[model samples]
Target: MSTTTAVDPTKTSSLRSGRRFGDAIFSALSHSAGIVILLVLIGVTFFLFWGAKDALVADGSEVRGGAGLIAYIGPLIFGTLLSSIIALLIAVPLSIGIALFISHYAPRRLASGLGYVVDLLAAVPSIIFGLWGMQIAGSAVPSFEFLNEYLGFIPLFSGTVTTTGRTMLMIGIVLAIMILPIMTAVNREVFLQTPRLHEEASLALGATRWEMIRQTVIPFGKSGVVSGAMLGLGRALGETMAVAIILSASGGGYSWELLSANTPGTIAGDIALNFPESFGVERSTLFVSGLALFVVTFLVNMFARWIISRRSEFSGAN
Candidate 1:
């Protein structure tokens, strides 16, 4: 037989009251943090607009680029997007392949070691990458002549071959290496999180290892891969030091010929390279470029979020 002791009303009430109080405090703190972030973002947007107003309304001759605001910023925007896209194109496949090998194909001991090495790469400074690109990758400029001979029909490679080795392509390759670890780490974790049950079921159905991965693992982690790619792109877009150090771009010279020495300036690199010497409307113009970068990064992140939240098989939240 068991005896039940009657609870004291005061004690029970006190316990419930304490829990509610704790919950309220936690909720308030979380809400305040989120609100603070939103407020900071709003403040930054307002500040950029305010600073850029003079340049935006000013005459072309008064501006640094000797062109209107749109014309000045056009090449910066193009270069920024082109560099980031190139990084994305190079990093994504390599990241996915390394992740697949680490998560599925490699021995457990080898996988762990390789993952550590990859993750360690993220800690390497951008300055180090820039130096390497300037000294080593820049030396390979002449080598691109081979590709141009065969691939010159492609518009991207059609321009006058660069002898300086400081073209847009060099910086793009540097950015790709810099962002590689981030995407690889994200992809490896996502691939590892694939449901064991699904993998087993695929295998039980007489699927090969590759088939099991294709049918189960890849589909399950597609959302994560997209998110990771976006994150890497954001870094690539904002990268300044490396681009500033590697690109030999002159003024507002926008060119679609990526392999040429006449590389278009990127917004971040332009701002970094010019901000110290900039004055009056020129400084304001730099602010406008910053604002553009802010918008682009924000939109990319939001789009990635929307994609991840969509009712797709990979999202797992349907």
Candidate 2:
């Protein structure tokens, strides 16, 4: 038995309008930020291509091995892909293993500590990794000599091992280590995010812990693993300082021999080594090489995305 308080329709309308206005403002800001990022990427790509045009049109210069745009970039492409592939091959499995141990097998406190250590590795500068690769890791691995000795029959391994062991294989190994922390960090987070309910259900069905992970965790995290691997590959592809420091590319071109003293040609390394001395057409050619690398990386990323999207359909991740 109390008097009814009448709600003002105008007040409710104003409140609803205010919320809608706020949401609209937030959404617009987010969309604008994304657009700005996209525009910046496009602008950079355009600049690279524009800078490379002079080199592309010029006749083959004897200085650049009488190689036109295609020839100029071809070996660098091969080197970049080869080194990155090797790094991924070595890093991915180890990263996944480390991630699994941290996510599932380790004590919570220990896992947290280990994760911090792994993250700390990523904070180390690329220059430091390059220095270590040049000074320490290069000499520490005698496996290069061993491989050259025993596996020399294989074309891939057939090469003279340098005193410094600064071979493509060594670069790949160092790149693998450089990328390990990043791959591990991403994979661990993804694995940790695997649905607890699914894991519990698998275990409740009398599955062993390993079996539970195999059935529940791996399936859930497969896409995430691929994503992390691709991220590492991107890093390896663009790595400059380490490759430049560790690689002894002296022949003015790329080499495929993993154990060769000839350092694998990479765009970033090439730019670092030659840009200072480059002039006019030579400088333009360097820009051309950068454009090529940009295209290659872009394509690789697109391919990875396509693969992930296709797999997602079957994996029920969609």
Candidate 3:
């Protein structure tokens, strides 16, 4: 024989109603947040375009550089890309290696300490980095006279060396150091998240530690490395203070000479230096430069997203 208990209709209805109420509230909150973010992005885009309208349509003579939009903004964009590229080239590989060591190879105690140190490094202010780059680090650039003298045959090293030691090369190095912590932190986290089973299985198949890392770990964390590198690149691109402080204006146009004081001007640096004194067309021109930066940044992010998406197409769903 089976016994059955009658359910209370009042309790059942109340429970369903409460759940529906909570879900509605949650949906409303999430939708509101997304709308707010979208609105802010739209606002920024509107500001950039509206502020730049005057300069975008202005005559070459009225513009700051007296050479028109492309001619003037070209050098700044080129410089920005060049310096950021230099920093990425130096930082990405080093960051990955350090992260791998911290996550996979180091003693737990030492790794814990190192992780804290990296986080602290990230928390340090950008302006402090600028001051340090300008004063302490820039001084070391002159010591690389051998690079200039011996490798002078290369156009990159062929330039009039300055006594102050402020050059594009130093800016790149400073940017590298500034962005290192960010990339390393992301990489370490990603590496740590690699499946224990996958790693162990590779090792159990007669693979050495390095071989397991090469096959299982690197493949799993490759996307993370790209994402982290993109983040570092973004920071490098928008770097205003460090580049402004270290950048000495000898020739504020595009240059292939990394060792020279005659380095190219970045858009952000140029705007910071000139915006206060600017007026009329010059002011609008600066806005146009800002718009250019926004465009470039957006394009870069899109390209990176495309790359990651393409890579994902070849990866297993799991």
Candidate 4:
């Protein structure tokens, strides 16, 4: 004979209800955290706009005819975009090559070690990179002389090379180095995620390793590569210490001479250099510049997202 044991329905129901309550609490907490983050972003944007409204509305004075919003930030915006673009052009290809090497060419141990080394670069302080750019890279690269020698006919490079070598070209090169590690790390992970079956199938079809990478790995990781490039550009655009330290702030206005000592000034650099002495409208102008930068970065990221989405749709179609 066997004795049957009965479960308590009330207790079981209570346990289920308690779990549901706990889940609800956690769900609400997570949602609250997300809302808080959005609120903080909104608050900061409001603060910037509020501070900049005066500067935005200011009319040009007799002394400084082009002293209004567009004049104040036109060069800064140009410099920021120019430098960031230069940095991305230099960094992206190198980053892809380095990432591909680490992900596919290097031995397992070597790959891991190289990856660690690359990542370690990101951990270094921006101040250190600035210092390195000022002291070592500026002198070592000889970009000024090279640009003047080869590309002097071009308007951007047609300038007298400064002995100090604190030109936009130099700043761009330093920014490239600063951004390289991050781009490489991101691309490395993306490349590594390419399906092994796809790679093997490509090889089975008599495709060489390089060919396989071109057809399979690169296609699979195209969006990731673009993302990595965008991330690097974002960092380069907002870089303050590096640009401030590497560039000469003596010139008060913008010039198109990228190789000249008195090159176009960046918003981040200008803000850092002048914020200490700025007051009243001048301070508000800096906020306006910052707001411009925020908008530019936002638009760039949005453009990148749109590109990624289009690529995804195309991939899905195939």
> What TM-score, over all chains together, does every model reach?
0.91, 0.90, 0.91, 0.88
RMSD of each: 4.3, 4.8, 4.4, 5.5
lDDT of 1 by residue, 1-318 (tens): 235566667665544644477889999999999999999989998999999898888888888777777788888999999999999999999999999999999999999999999999988999889888999765786777876888889998877888877878888899999999999999999999998999999999999999999998888889889989998999999999999998877753667787887778899999999999999999998998898999989888998888777767546545
**lDDT score, candidate 3:** 0.86
Number of clashes recorded per candidate:
0, 0, 0, 0
lDDT scores of the candidates, listed in order: 0.88, 0.85, 0.86, 0.86
**What are the per-residue Cα lDDT tens digits for candidate 3 across 149-194?**
8898998788777667788888888899999999999999988988
lDDT of 1: 0.88
Runs with alpha carbons beyond 4 Å of true place in candidate 3: 1-19
The deviation in Å at residue 127 for candidate 3 is 1.2
**What does candidate 4's lDDT look like per residue over 1-318, in tens digits?**
235456566665443644477889999999999999999989989999998877777665411224567776887898999899989989999999999999999999999999999999977888888998899645744757887889889987887877887878788888999999999999999999998988999999999999999989998998999999998999999999999998985553566677777777788998898889877777888899999999999999999989888757645225
lDDT, residue 267, model 1? 91
User: Between candidates 1 and 3, which one is better according to lDDT?
Assistant: 1
Better of 1 and 4 by lDDT: 1
Which of the numbered candidates is closest to the native, going by highest lDDT? 1
